[model samples]
Target: MSLLEHLEELRRRLIHSVIYLVVGFFVAYGFHEKIYQLMQAPITFALKKHNLPTQLVIHNPVDGFNMYLKISFMVGCIVAAPLILYQVWLFISPGLYKNEKRYVMPFMVATITLFLSGAFFGYRWVFPGSLDFLFAYSHEFRPLIEVNEYTDLFLTVILGLGISFELPILVLFLSLFGIVSPKFLWKNIKFAILIVFIIAAIITPTPDPLTMCVFAAPLLFLYLLSIGVSFMVHPARRKRLKEAA
Candidate 1:
């Protein structure tokens, strides 16, 4: 395909993705209250564990509606994630060989699964723990967290975790495209570790060592896993081994 054709195809895919997101948005909006309750569970649990007030505050008159809208939008994005991923694959599949293109199902499944797993990990473990730690000072000061602010923080942490968990998928694609190999990753393991810690430090909401370790440990494991994945998928690695055999 010509450059113009590729651009047009990308535009079409984006439009389709947008449509899917919009549909998901409306569906999520219909259950916005339930979604809000679900998201608030972590905070509620934290508050109860700390014996603090379990209610979030609203500073603005429109904060409640705005929060609902935000929650719906987030839920919509999550609902439409598979479609968006499919569109992404469609956009790039034209550049791949038939054999490579056959990975579409696996790619989508892995992407979605990793994302949800990361989100669940954040919500179930990281968020509550972080919230409890941050609110540990409630005995000295009254805690009145605004609904919007809480939502923003929650989304930032959850989304960051979700995106970070895609490291393996990203590495797999890079290996498949011959951009990096298992040997290269293994050789640069030290640098990768340094980068992973830096990213974990940035992504972790708190400066505590434990939280940082929580984020970094999985990432380091994923890096090693990616190296193994690269050994399996990298064309040069396969070719060299085949020749040796």
Candidate 2:
């Protein structure tokens, strides 16, 4: 395709993705209250465990409403993720061979599964543990967990992990395009470990080594998985295996 045609196609995909997100936003807005409750649950549990008040405080009157809108938007992104991924695939499909295009289903499935798994891990273990660690200090002072601030931290942990879990998928694309090979990835594994730990340190709410390890563990696993994925999808390896078959 010409450059102009490629640009037009990208525009079309963007429009479709935006429309899907808007629809998802409205749907999520309808259940925004429930979503807020779910988001607030970890903090509530932590406060209870610490024998503190379970309510999250809001200094400004509009903070509650703003949080509601933010929650809706985030949930909208989750709802629209599959459609947005599909739009992305469609945009890139023209460059792939027929056999490669057949991976669309697996790609979508793996992307969604890995993202949800990471989000769930953060919500179930990392977030609650961090909240407990933070709230442990409330023994000396009254805790006033602000709604907006809490929401920001919550999203940072959850969405950050979700996006991070897409490492294998990212590597798959790089290998498919012949940008990297399994040997290169393996050779650089030490560097990848260093980078992963750095990111875990940055993102983990707690300063403890245990919490940081909990955050970094899955990311390291995903990096290893990416190496394997590269081996499978790298053009030279795939072609050699096909010829042997």
Candidate 3:
């Protein structure tokens, strides 16, 4: 393609992405109050469980309104994610082979599923555990919590989970490219587990083992799953072993 063609394609995709995000933003903003309430549940629950009278307080005067905007924008991005993915696929799809194209639908579905699942896991399981742990530790002291600080923690965990859930896709991409192999991964399983804990330790804000394990376990499982996928790519290894036998 010529430079003009590439530029045209770029412009087209950008326009589509922007449209999707704007639509998402509007829809999310509409539900911003409900979303904020929903997000605050875990922290509130934890506080209640500990019998603490304190609620998250806002030091900044504008925090309450600004937080709603941030929450709405986040929701909007999620609402528009499919369109963003489609636009991304559209941009790259023209370059893919027939076999590659065949994989696109499944990949698209899997991408959304994994991302949602990760977000869900964080919200459902990890959130309460983490929130409870933190609040429980600090409850006796009764430190004033800022709304921004609480919101930031909530978003950061959800974002981390969303990113972490891309494990299968990352593995598949690496396997497709032949950069990593099943045997090589299997031989380095110890290192992989170590890496998983190291990553969990680095990424998670809380030092509680349960919180760390909650994040690390799935990542470790993904590494193992990646090895399984790598085997499918290297069937020649099986044939070679058979010939040697």
TM-score of 2: 0.97
Each model's lDDT: 0.89, 0.93, 0.81
On TM-score, the candidate that comes out on top is: 2
Candidate 1 off by > 4 Å: 238-245
- Candidate 1 Cα deviation (angstroms), residue 233: 2.7
lDDT of 3 at 199: 79
Candidate closer to the true structure by lDDT (higher is better), 1 or 3: 1
Report clash pairs, candidate 2: none
Residue-level lDDT tens digits of model 3 in 1-245: 88899899999999989999999999998888799889989888888898876477887789998898888888899889887988878877776545457767887898899888888988898888887888778766876778888888888888778878787777765665567777788999999899889978876768988789989999888777778867764545545655896
Could you give candidate 2's per-residue lDDT for residues 1-245 as a string of tens digits? 99999999999999999999999999999999999999999999988898888988899999999999999999999999999999999998888777789999999999999999999999999999998888785479898789999999999999999999999999998998999999999999999999999999999998899999999999999999999999988999878877997
Which ranking of candidates, highest lDDT first?
Answer: 2, 1, 3
Candidate 3 achieves a global lDDT of 0.81
Window of ten residues with lowest summed lDDT in model 2 = 135-144
> Every model's Cα RMSD, please?
2.1, 1.2, 4.0
Off by over 4 Å in 2: 241-245
